[model samples]
Target: MEHSIFVMCILAVLSIALANPIFQDFSQLKAVENANKVLQLVDQEVLSNHKLGQQSSLPQKIDWREKGYVTNVKDQGQCASCWAFASAATMEGQLFNKTNNLITLSEQNLLDCAKSYNDKGCAGGWMSHAFKYIRDNGIEADGTYPYTATKQECSFNEANSVGTLQNYVKLTKTTEEEILKAVANHGPVGVYVYMSSLFMGYKSGIFEDDSCTETPNHAVTVVGYVNTPQDQYWIIKNSFSKSWGEDGYMRMKMNKNVCGITYRLYYPIV
Candidate 1:
C-alpha cells in the first residue's frame, strides 16, 4: 500500500491545478525521493512475468538484434519523426516473427502517405495510426521507398508493398512490469520517451533521470531487457543514427517507467 500511495501522489502531482501543499512545495525534492521507487518495489525476478515452474526455461537475457530479429537502427535526421522509425521497427520485428525473413519496411511511406491517418509527416505521428494505415493500405519495402527523413510526395506503389498488418495490439492501463513483459514476450515494442536535455546528452550507462518530467517527446523501440547481479535495464533502439547512444540504442533504466516509457507502448501484428 505504500507503493500505491506513492503512485497516486505522483500522478496527482502531475496535475497542473492540484493545490496539494506537497505539489506546490518541494516538488523537485519529492521527484528525487521517488526516483528509485520502482527499483526498490519491483522484484527483479518478475522482469519477464514468468510462471514459477517455468522460470528455469526463461532466457537469462533477451536482445532481439543478437538473434537477427531486429534490423539495423536507422537515422531520422533533423525530423521529429522518430514515431515513424519506432512504428517501422515494430513492424520489422513482427514481420520477422511471421516470415522469419528480416525485411525493412518503409517509414517514408507512412510519413508521406499517412497524413490522413493522423500523421504529420516530419512534424510527428503515432504508431497506432500508422498501423491503421498499414492495415488499409499496406507498407512498401525500404528498398522501394527509402527514407529521406524529410516530407516528400507520396509515391507509394502497392506492387512494391511487402508487409500488411492483420491487426495491432495496444495495451492500456499498463505498468512498468506490464511494459517489460510486452517487450520480452512480444518482441520489439513501440514506446515513447521524453527527450529531456539531460537525456539527449546521454552517452552510455543505464540512464535514469530524477528530474525528468512525465512527458514524452520522442518515440522509440524497446528491443530487449537484462537483469544482472550488478544492475538491470532495458535495451531501446533509437532513431538518432548509429553515432548516438550505444550505437543507435539506449539501455533505459528499467522499473521506473523512465520518461513516461510505459505510456504509448504498442506492437504491430503482421
Candidate 2:
C-alpha cells in the first residue's frame, strides 16, 4: 500500500509540473491560436495578390556594403538564450557592414557570460538587454571567446579584437509600423518575436496563420517588407538548425492584428 501511494504521488507531481502556466500559459496560447487564424486569412489574400505578379518590388535590397546583411541564428533547441542568438546576429551584421570584415561572432559567449543584465543566456531575453550590454561594454569576435552553447562567466576584453563597431542601430519598439518603416528605409531589420512549433525548423514558403502565439520563442531578422494588394508581408530569415526556407529564409505577414513584431533597428547617429 505504501509503495502504491508513493508511486501515485510521483505521477501527480510530474503532471502538475508539466501543466505549469509559466512553462505554457493558456491565455497566450489562445492569442497565438487566434493569430494563426488571422494568418490563414492573410494566405488567401496573398494568393489573390500573387495573380498580379510582383505587386511590390522587393524593398530595395540594402547595399550589402553600406547597410547590413540581416541573418538568423540556428535555434539551440530548448536553450532559452534566444536573446544571445538575436544579439549576436545584430552585431555580426553591423560589424560586417561597417568594417567589411566577415567574422562570425560568438553568440555562445553572450549566452554563457552576459548575466548581470537580467539575461538568462539559454533561457531567453529581450534584444534591448543584449544591446545595452554592448553599449555599456562592447563585444568581441567568435575567434575571441568562441561559442560553446553552454552558460559561463563573461570575460569582456576590449583590446583582443580589431576595430570597434560603428554605424549600428537598435530599434526602440517592435511594432509592425516601426519595423515596416525601418525595412522600407534601411536594408534589413533584426527582430525577436515569439514563434510557435509550426515556426520551429521552418524552411521555406510563406508562414500561414496558425493559432499558436502564447510564447514568442524564437529570434529572426526582417530583411524586407512588401505591401501586397491583399496584405503586407515581411521577408524574414530564420536560424533553424539548418539553412532552410528560400535558401534559409521565410516570409511572415505583418498582421497588425496579431502581435508579431519584437525588435527594430535605429540607424546609428553618424
Give the local distance difference test score of model 1: 0.73
How far does residue 85 in candidate 2 sit from its true spot (Å)? Answer: 1.5
Q: TM-score of every model?
A: 0.78, 0.64
TM-score of 1: 0.78
- Indicate which candidate wins on TM-score: 1
**Superposition TM-score, candidate 2 onto the true structure:** 0.64
Give the alpha carbon lDDT tens digit for every residue of 95-135 in model 1.
89988999988899999998787677765666777888999
**Model 2 ranges off by over 4 Å:** 1-78, 162-174, 228-232, 243-247, 256-259, 262-270
Best by lDDT: 1
Tell me how candidate 2 scores on lDDT.
0.51
